[model samples]
Target: MIEYVPVIESPCMSLCVMDEASGWCLGCGRTLDEIARWGQTDQADRDAVMAALPARMERLEGKAL
Candidate 1:
């Protein structure tokens, strides 16, 4: 029997612009470290980060999360 694992989708929007003031990517609102480590993270961790993205983007864009 084979065990199957789900793949986590990257948050990249392909904008790839870095916001120097916030140190986060303008497209995905992820820090360089987060982008770097995302591929190696497990599903639970990826989910946690995904859950937080909306709030982070809202804050970065000066909107309510």
Candidate 2:
């Protein structure tokens, strides 16, 4: 049997502040919907998110977000 894992598991660090500009979690780069529904998603979904992290971080650094 194969096992699947999630790349992002709601990066909420108790800050829970919604970024009005992007609607993204303040702590984690995941969207609110992602945080709301993590356990249900499959590894593929997480992998996708993981793949986007570098670009996302780049964006963050580029814009200093």
Candidate 3:
């Protein structure tokens, strides 16, 4: 029998711009280290990062206003 493993997709928006002040990617809201280790990270860890993105983006947007 084969075991099923789910794939955790990356959140890259192709913007690839890093905000020097926060150290987060403007497009995906991921830190440099998070982006670097994404492929090697497990599902739970990836999910945790994904969970944090919305708030990060919201904060970034708030800063823009």
TM-scores of all candidate predictions against the true structure: 0.76, 0.59, 0.85
Q: What stretches of model 3 exceed 4 Å from their correct place?
A: 1-7
How do the residues 1-65 of candidate 2 rate in per-residue lDDT, one tens digit apiece?
88895355544567566667777655556677777667788878877876765665466456663
Tens-digit lDDT track of model 3 for 25-60: 999999999999998988899999999999999988
State residue 32's C-alpha deviation in candidate 1, in Å. Answer: 0.6
Q: Please provide the root mean square deviation of candidate 1 (C-alpha atoms, Å).
A: 3.7
- What's model 1's overall lDDT? 0.84
Candidate 3 TM-score, C-alpha based:
0.85
Deviation from native of the Cα of residue 44 in model 3, angstroms: 0.8
By lDDT rank, best first, the candidates go 3, 1, 2
| Candidates 1 and 3, the one with greater lDDT | 3
| Candidates' C-alpha lDDT | 0.84, 0.64, 0.92
Model 1, 1-65: lDDT tens digits are: 99997766999999988878888788898988889899897779888888988987887788323
Clashes of 1: 0
Off by over 4 Å in 1: 1-6, 63-65
Report per-prediction Cα RMSD to one decimal. 3.7, 5.0, 2.6
Number of the top-ranking candidate, with TM-score as the measure = 3
